[model samples]
Target: MGLEFLDVFEQWANSYDESVGGQNREYKAVFAGYEQILEAVTERSMGHVMEFGVGTGNLTKKLLDKGLNVTGIEPSVPMRGIAEAKLGSKEIILDGDFLHFPDIINVNTIVSTYAFHHLTDKEKNEAIAKYGKLLSKGGRIVFADTMFESVEDYTNAIVKAREEGFHNLAKDLETEYYTTIPILRTILERSGFTVGFKRCNDFVWLMEGEKQ
Candidate 1:
């Protein structure tokens, strides 16, 4: 679970939208083409969607607008509150993380954006395994997050962030649980998903995994 960052999310609740909108130069590249990334995730999702890390309900809104049934899960109280307020009383946004969500039914598609990296590689593997067991054949997982093509690329990204005087971005890169493509592919495949990745920007990539 990524609950260890609850305080960070609470603090970021108010400014998360602005930061993703490219207001924070240090994180601007990370969130480049923010709307398109959300749309990309939304476009891949269908039928009874369950969204993890629904921060501020941005992606939730898109899924809802697409006429998909969505249940949102957020670990941070303030973030959930903001998302609830934004999406209004009609939608259900629950308090949970990837591994600790309430039991949901008929969730054929799971979608998340810019949030899964909070989990360490081990946790990521566990989450994928859990989803593999929960989903039936043809169910899908669509996530857009900052992932590297390789460990060398991961290291280079941190170095570039540091060279650009993006100390916060560099520290975040080093501190968070960002992982490489091979590891994610291995985990998803081991868990029985046929997965694929598409670059969304310099930093983010869209990972779509269909359960087989």
Candidate 2:
């Protein structure tokens, strides 16, 4: 059995800003960590930096501020509009899911936050494989997201969510596509990217890869 649950990620498109899930000090810290990775890896700016699921331009604004030429792709129409307004980069951004793309073009470095878990397990694997092929050699890929060690871990997340004033609808997601450190490593390895992960805390982790 694979993942059958659908939270229909679009549900959060408009209301995300109001939700506690969207506003947090930890989230800002996570974004800063990604920026640190970007600064460390990106020695020379070549081609375009792309971020899948660029919601509301949180990280997008930071990257843009750093003078990085970025192209953002997003699935939710409302979210894409929000990102466009927030990012103010009309020409470089596109609105569509990564699956629809024939290939993710001009990607020298890819950064995604809280977006990878939105895909089904199979799709996640396939997307990683495609990402490997599309990226320029020696390109770095950075990601930050919430993941758990097990089902019990998700239960704990639910309790944490209760404190945050939302429900952990992702509890039924058992494929580890949503939360497995081991799977994160294996998928990237099989996809032809070198895998690395850093634990931010009990709830989140940063996964990085090199297109090799």
Candidate 3:
């Protein structure tokens, strides 16, 4: 699935937290209100959660603190190690990605933050379809990630990043498969979910989809 970015994650493992904490100016806007975003995702999640891309276990910790049973899946070894260390021995983070994960049972809510855009639109569709089949009625998928309102907005964001001399941010925007709202809505609805979106920050939106 998103394993192609494994090396990136591996390299980022040590600095991921700092980057999200707004220590890095280039990504500050991207991770603006990081704590609040994680809280929003945690608030929406329900029983037996499956968390994809549990980098450093930040969101995973929030879910656990909310008294929710969580299964964390991370593809990067170093990221998983850091998460394991952070979450301690009680929690087990599995090896997986958006499309491929261990056969987890009773995962009524799926939660992820700032990570789903690693998948291309086609892969995103496949992942959503897989989740649709796996979840029962009333189950949910709550994700917060960078997405655009339109193609024009997407283009403008990259241009703005470039103008601000955030070449890394600009390149990331250009390289990754960041998609638009309409596309995500279509995918979620087609997969039999009633979905809604709320802006979390300038670069992130919280997408909540309930299985129908």
Candidate 4:
């Protein structure tokens, strides 16, 4: 059978929280920068907030703490369970996939953290179209995840993994979906979003667009 993003993630369910989902305290501290980006997005946002792939609510507390009305879409049952458990009775935790949600929510803006990169190119493009179609006029989307900086990073990672006998770690590091900046920007543009910014580390991006 063909591989799916959810499939691989499901297999990594146990490690999902500790690895990159920001469940651990150290991970959360390291991810503080991304949280700042999400906060800025929330502050500038004019309407509702929707998260397409909210894994374990790493950013959930930050968003909810702001008292912003936010909803999230997650496909992994285990991950969803963790998130729902943390966000009890909030009613915003919906068990669904971003590209195949049964209901449509037209909001002012949408944001996600570290989740979009898991999707395949086809699903990513489809999601842009599907979600963009649901954006209210003047709405926007802002998200940040791994954006590839160099092919050498992939090569070096693989090489290091082989030397260290850490195949699983290497495989997980392969999620540099937005290999180049322009490619992702082009896709978003075609889907009616003007590229705001795409940044990493101390860098930050605020690519957004009005529903046209």
Candidate 5:
């Protein structure tokens, strides 16, 4: 699954920013969530930030404008190339997934947008634990992505996707795993984080967990 997804992204890397879902009406909802997330992060005083899956550098460009130092982790070679082009040749973008991205230290914030669902549930927990360990004291993770309440909810979402003519998307959803708010909160709390969440809509959510 990982290699397959990677191949798909590699193929789409050059045109991702102009893809159907990237700038179409279908993306308005995601853009709205991105705006809210930018606002939320801007209100806080975050020092060093690590962003995983920095696809196409849309959000990374905004963070750079805020004068924040960001380290990006992306596995796709072509995608990383595009991101580096957007962020400039010097900005550091490590070529690995979150679990394997190296040399991270003293990071105050770790953020990912619409990325983690690519991971299995066990991998999600593992990534959360890694985030807890990598961050400096009082550091937090601000994750914005598609989240569901349960497997049933995920199933319903898949059904809706198919009904909306997103058959391929629905098919992909069958194999991908997404975490729920309750499960995510429990995992973070167990890992010594104080958790908070906001629902952006039926499918998208923002979760923050500050290390204690």
Candidate 6:
């Protein structure tokens, strides 16, 4: 998978919250799902929480307001700066891609949104293993992003898009790699996590896993 999206994200960072997609119903639903994920994390363990790819502190600010100690990792300076301005010293936003961040052990909960798609399936599985080790017992992982149950599901979406006259959109979807939700569940379970998931939209889903 290409990281060209990073350049787009860099350009979109400052205006992300105000972008046209930001005002769409899909984005609103995803944001609601993010809140639910954070609420669930707080219920599980209020100790230490880290958000991978915490762009502009959208959910991070909510975490802080609810009084959970939060840390965020964001590679984009522009996005991180906006988050920093909103969060102040209430939380720390680390600078680096999440996989390379060395001090992640013993956290109570890990959350990420719309970011893991940047990783290939192999890399995503590697991350699952790493997250398994980083979490404390009974800790949880909360993720919200584009996920499908299988390749067929992904393909069907594309076909449906083309049928619905979204040819240009279908063309874009054809190029990206998305994690299969069932495969992700199996990987997390192998890493000792019991998982659950909910669909947020046609191509987006929210997943939760509790370390067992």
List, residue by residue over 1-212, the lDDT tens digit for candidate 4. 01257776576567755655456443343254665666665665555778777777766666777777787877777777778887774478777775666574557677776666666667677888876788866787777665544556546655775576665545656643534455567778888876766554522345555566
What's the best-to-worst order under TM-score?
3, 1, 5, 6, 4, 2
**Tens-digit lDDT track of model 6 for 57-158:** 877877777788888888887888888888775248987675777486558888887788777777777888988888867888888778888889888877
Model 5 ranges with Cα > 4 A deviation: 1-4, 19-33, 38-45
Candidates in order, TM-scores: namely 0.98, 0.75, 0.98, 0.76, 0.88, 0.83
lDDT (10s digit) by residue, model 1, range 1-212: 78888888998899999999999998899999999999999989989999999999999999999999999998888998899899885358988899998999888998899889999999999999999998899999999999999999999999999899999889889988999999999999999999999999999999999999
Model 4 misplaced stretches (Cα beyond 4 Å): 1-3, 7-34, 37-41, 149-167, 175-178, 202-212
Candidate 4 pairs with clashing backbones: 196-207, 197-205, 197-207
Candidate 2 TM-score, C-alpha based: 0.75
Clashes of each: 0, 0, 0, 3, 0, 0
What count of clashes does model 2 give? 0
* Residue range 17-85, candidate 3, lDDT tens digits: 999999999999999999999999999999999999999999999999999989999889899999999
Candidate 6: residue pairs that collide: none
Candidate lDDT scores, in order, read 0.93, 0.64, 0.93, 0.64, 0.76, 0.74
lDDT of 2 by residue, 1-212 (tens): 11132234456567655542435443332234544443433333345788777777767777777788888877666677777887666765676665654255667887777677777667878878878878867887787776666657766766664565443333423333565777777888897888777775455677888878
Between candidates 3 and 4, the lDDT winner: 3
**Which 10 residues in a row give candidate 5 its minimum summed lDDT?**
20-29
